[model samples]
Target chain A: MPYIKVQITRENVTSEQKLQIIQGATDLMVNILNKDPEATFVVIEEVDTDNWGVAGEQVTTLRKRQAEAKKLAEANKPK
Target chain B: MPYIKVQITRENVTSEQKLQIIQGATDLMVNILNKDPEATFVVIEEVDTDNWGVAGEQVTTLRKRQAEAKKLAEANKPK
Candidate 1:
């Protein structure tokens, strides 16, 4: 209920991927908090990176964070 | 700094008008709270109407609210 909807503009993701992310986000919210997806309302907008920024900073940081997190998760994977 | 960005899907507004709305929203924040527009990052995504909803309600309510407010203001116009 108190989540912020984020719109990302990038060339790497397709519309199907965006929809998957939205559904995945809703699942994360529900699984983590036992909330309904309908009440949780998820919206994802795909945009051009040049068109969006964060605190006067480019949203490249978001992608960077995701990449780093993935690397960390892979590194900690058990055999 | 704590504002939620809203993406609107409508047919009546141009991109320039959307930009104006973004600037106006930032102005409202600054004027009402004395905040810096730069610090108050604004992002506006133009969405398709079918892609947006509000609490299981269509976003047509938003446009209706605006129209009603405008009509009320016009009716109360001072001579």
Candidate 2:
């Protein structure tokens, strides 16, 4: 069982959305590796945005990195 | 990989204690299931005690339940 835990700053997501995210992540795992979602425990934890970081940088910076990567990928596409 | 996440209220524990807890839990898994710690990702999240619960009951009550169970078992022992 591959356990994936997500620490999210956004607390406003409904329980259904939370379950969907868990299932969606589990689905990705299952689709990629043929693992059973029932065998995988995916936990999504809601935490204060200020409490998490990555590579000694704030999470907002990480989000920005994703957005920048998407922009760069879009720019490089053949028109 | 079974990822076990622990959300604790006590925040002032030494980093050593934190690591020890992670290793201890991982050791239990390893001893029980012969799982590799490297492959079995166990993440322990430090959360406010007020934010966590079990079976619609607070974590403190859960601790009490464990203590009570131990006491009952002790009382029933042949020794």
Candidate 3:
């Protein structure tokens, strides 16, 4: 059986999006790996920003910093 | 970098248990694979029974059937 796990930040992802991800992953295995759809499993995991980290920093903090940088850049854009 | 993911049915797992899993998984990589703990990532995913399947049936339905069978067997036990 082919099992796939997809992890993403918990950002209000809809059930419809999850369904699409499951279908897409299953399709990829079936098409490329010639895996049986009936035996394939796809699981989606949503982790909170506070729990996820990048570059030794929590994603929650990283997002806030990134947003502030983007705002500063926009304010400095040429007229 | 080594990334480990553990998936289990969501059954009121506590934060402490999750922390243990993360630590245990990281230790495994460190001891056996000789991976750096700083570069190792462990993610624990808790899935709903309805979302997980086994033997072509949802885990929710399978658990119900299994519980009923266990109850029936207990009822038939000798006095």
- In each prediction, how many residue pairs overlap at the backbone (N, C-alpha, C within less than 3 A)? 1, 0, 0
What does candidate 1's lDDT look like per residue over A37-65, in tens digits? 56765555566766778788667776688
lDDT of 3 by residue, B1-79 (tens): 8877677898788666666666677778878988887787766667999999988999999989999999999999999
Model 3, range A1-79, lDDT digits (tens) per residue? 8999898989899999999999999999999999999999999878966555443344566689999999999999999
Best by lDDT: 3
Candidate lDDT values, in order: 0.67, 0.68, 0.81
Q: What is the C-alpha RMSD of each candidate to the true structure, in Å?
A: 11.7, 11.7, 8.7
| Per-residue accuracy of model 2 over B1-79 as CA lDDT, tens digit each | 7788775555477889888988898998899999987887767676443333332233444577889999999999997
Return the top candidate by DockQ. 1
For model 1, how does the per-residue alpha-carbon lDDT over B1-79 read when each residue is reduced to its tens digit?
7464756665678878877878898998899999877788777666654334444333455568889999999999998
- Give the better candidate number (1 or 2) by TM-score: 1
lDDT of 3 at B25: 76
The most accurate candidate by TM-score is 3
Better of 1 and 3 by DockQ: 1
Q: Rank the candidates by TM-score, best first.
A: 3, 1, 2
